[model samples]
Target: SQTIHQWPATLVQPVGSPLSLECTVEGTSNPNLYWYRQAAGRGLQLLFYSVGIGQISSEVPQNLSASRPQDRQFILSSKKLLLSDSGFYLCAWTENYEQYFGPGTRLTVT
Candidate 1:
């Protein structure tokens, strides 16, 4: 069985602070990982996805970036935050085209 993990279930940050979001998958190997966002009144959107260590893809022009440091760990980062960047963040791991998502992180920027 595989499980996904995400840290800091909720966050409240100022508009200019740095941000780091982490997600890890257990019971799997070299799984494709992804970071997704769901803002208020909007649909879920893919922020980044990774097929392997050091391989990442970004889907949006927002201030967020992602990296895969290990085979099963993915991270999302930001140097400067914005109010519009606040949203519900999700981490997912895929196997055989099925995506299993971890509990999301709720970020609020003010």
Candidate 2:
């Protein structure tokens, strides 16, 4: 049984602050990892994805970046957060084209 974990289910950050969110998978190896952001009442937008360790592809170029340092560890980071960065951040893993999402982290920027 594969499962994904994401921390700090909700977050509040000021404008222009640093951001770091972590996600990990258990019971799976070399699974495709992805970071997606969902705006209020909108669908998810892919931020980044990784196929293997140290391999990442960015779907959007903004204040956010992603990295896969280990086969099962993925991280999303931002050096300077913006108000627009506030949203629901989700980490997911894919197997056979099906994706399983984490509980998500809601960020509120002010």
lDDT of each: 0.93, 0.95
Candidate 2, residues 2-104, lDDT tens digits: the string is: 9999987999999999999999999999999999999999999999999999999999889998889899999999999999999999999999999999999
Model 2 TM-score, 2 decimals: 0.97
TM-score of each: 0.97, 0.97
**5, model 1: CA deviation in Å?**
0.3
Clashing pairs in 2: none
Q: Candidate 1 lDDT (Cα, whole model)?
A: 0.93
Q: Which portions of model 2 show Cα errors greater than 4 Å?
A: none
**Over 4 Å off, model 1:** none
- With a 3 Å backbone cut-off (N, CA, C), the pairs that clash in candidate 1 are none
Highest lDDT: which candidate?
Answer: 2
- lDDT per residue as tens, model 1, 11-67: 999999999989999999989999999999898999999999999998988798899
Cα distance off (Å), candidate 1, residue 19? 0.2
